[model samples]
Target: MPNWVDGHPAESLSIKDRGLAYGDGLFETIAVRAGRPPLLEYHMARLAEGCQRLGIPLDLQLMRTELLAFSAGLGEGVAKLMITRGEGLRGYAPPPVALPRRILQSSPFPVYPQVNGVEGVQLFPCVTRLAEQPLLAGLKHLNRLEQVLARNEWQGSEFAEGLMRDQSGRVIEGVFSNLFIVHEGALITADLSRCGVAGVMRAALLDSARAQGLKVEVRDIPFEDFLQADEVFLCNSLFGVWPVRSVTGHHWPVGPLTRKLQAIARDLLDI
Candidate 1:
């Protein structure tokens, strides 16, 4: 049982909601620590940017207050805030005047795996490839059938995360996280300009690494190139950074670079 709305009853979700019908909405999963989200501003910025791109009227002040108040006093948790085009009249056409609908829920932080969010994690290269949609590229939208299919490929018991490719078979990223590999002391990640979610942690690392004078490249990644990398790690808003111990039976070391990155990540988390 959780608060679906800030002050509304549970039945607030209409059967006619577009988000439920066509997944015409967006969501942000925030990591909370000590009654506060670590990167609240960055999360909000990504949310606002998604809303603006989707033509959804976003009451930034209202959203900020509702979610913040709801998340307060929860030392460790996850907050998912979503907005959908409310109650459309059975069609793809935008409503003359859209009434936005929302869902906000908080849950105790998930007990990530023993190796996950800790020592390191394994990855399974998924057969499911994300479709090319420039309009939706880099936005964390509600349409996640791709991720659903990818996640179902193999239970994370054998592998911590699934690696997804783009339509052209270019290594895109992990199903629910951003991908980064350290090669010759330089960090390389996929160029999300075409597809994949532009993760907040990914953005921060890009900025932080640049500030630290580390070379960061946003380029297309081939499977062979990725497998041959010196070091690799995956990141999300919640799991700050998790080094890849292996990928599809190929062993990888939790290198010195990954440890250095993890040190910064520890400061960004509840630990």
Candidate 2:
């Protein structure tokens, strides 16, 4: 169960819980190891930036303490830390003095068979297109109806994920993870400024690739490019990385670069 303080499980959210009523909140799905969530700096930076964008006041020290107390002794698993504008007026107007709500919950880590990434996975070309909202784009906020619909559009085992496009018909990303396509031995992924989640793992890969002397292209991806790409992979914080074996009738290989990146990611995550 999730609640606003450490160890106290409240029955219901405060009537003014902005996230439930207005989706006025942000969240992070972090990987916890030894009961401690790693990459705290990156997550905190996102939180601080999210608060600035949403006009919410953020107390980083307080949040740090709460997170530490909440995840204490949980061993290893996934943790979702959320912050919402507490109680507020009935309308969209925020309260003058907002009481922020902090909610934390833990779950068993999603186990991935080592072979899953080593070999490859499948994908479905989702019919749903991500509606671009420049102001709210890439924040990982609570308004996730687009992802919900895209995910619900698929019910096949052949593909473990759905690749989504934007309203402009440009490929954006996978439903939850980031999309990367290899072309001519180069790394390419969607530029997520207009839409899509800015995944933490995807960021790590970008930085790691640059460090390893690989050029990463961030640009608009068209549908036709997938048919010509050498390889594809979907990445997220929890799953780390997964190579795409096929999409629709198009097939791809788990290339050397994909495997090398996966190995680097696995070592980084210590999985």
Candidate 3:
């Protein structure tokens, strides 16, 4: 239940921290269960890629040890690890000597209806479009205004998740989770090379789906295709997977493939 900033217990960040000033940081939301993080490698892989692209140095081994300790402390919860470029002066340019700051915090696992994963959930199509920034695509950086605004568009339990698209109306992903649709017995998900966070759960599912000999395709999904999908599901590290029952008026049954993958997720995530 302790929050650590650079290995020290700190509740507040420096006002000049680059993460606050310009959203110059990367974050990973890790699900800790039974004193361990199951999908940690996938999260670390993405974080490492993000740090490399942003020119931030990451000692993967060190971070792994820290995260394990953090997870053990919390026992069961979500661990958020934020790595920033540390404090900076007023400017757009990064400092020559990058003093990266690591902030680790934990929160209780979210409470949701048990039927969410069993039956399925309704999705609200959001109007807030994700900009096509190839440079920022697939990275879980600190900048999340797009998701914030999209999530703010709806309220209450009518929709458990919201579907977001690119400005061109290409179905991208969920406000938080990645989108996957079963089409003609194939598992299809958005191509995140242009925009959207390449979630750890998405990556893991892709591998698992392929290992099970399921057809998997990552490509641009049109709104019509998404609506016509045999079965739809949303996934993230925390929730594992949630089938989408409807979007607008279009409806889908919790299909065979969705259930198959849900079992895989439960095994992999131990949720």
93-150 per-residue lDDT for model 3 (tens digits)? 9998888999999899988898999999999989999999999999999999999999
Model 2, 10: alpha-carbon shift in Å?
4.1
Query: 1-271, model 1: which lDDT tens digit per residue?
Result: 3556534536367778899999988998988887788888888899899999999986888888877776774557897778887778878997989888778877778787757756688898899999999899999999999999999999638788988999888888899999999889989999988899999888877777888888889999987888889998998888788999887689778887777777677676655
Candidate 3 matches the true fold with a TM-score of 0.98
Error in Å for residue 104 of model 3: 0.6
lDDT at position 29, candidate 3: 93
Model 2 misplaced stretches (Cα beyond 4 Å):
1-11, 113-115
Compose the digit string of candidate 2's lDDT tens values, residues 116-142: 687788888898999988898888899
1 Cα displacement, candidate 2 (Å): 7.7
- The regions of model 3 sitting more than 4 angstroms off are none
Worst 10 residues of 2 by lDDT: 1-10
TM-score top scorer: 3
TM-scores for the candidates? 0.94, 0.93, 0.98
For model 3 the local lDDT of residue 260 reads 91
What shift in Å separates residue 46 of candidate 1 from its native position after superposition? 0.6
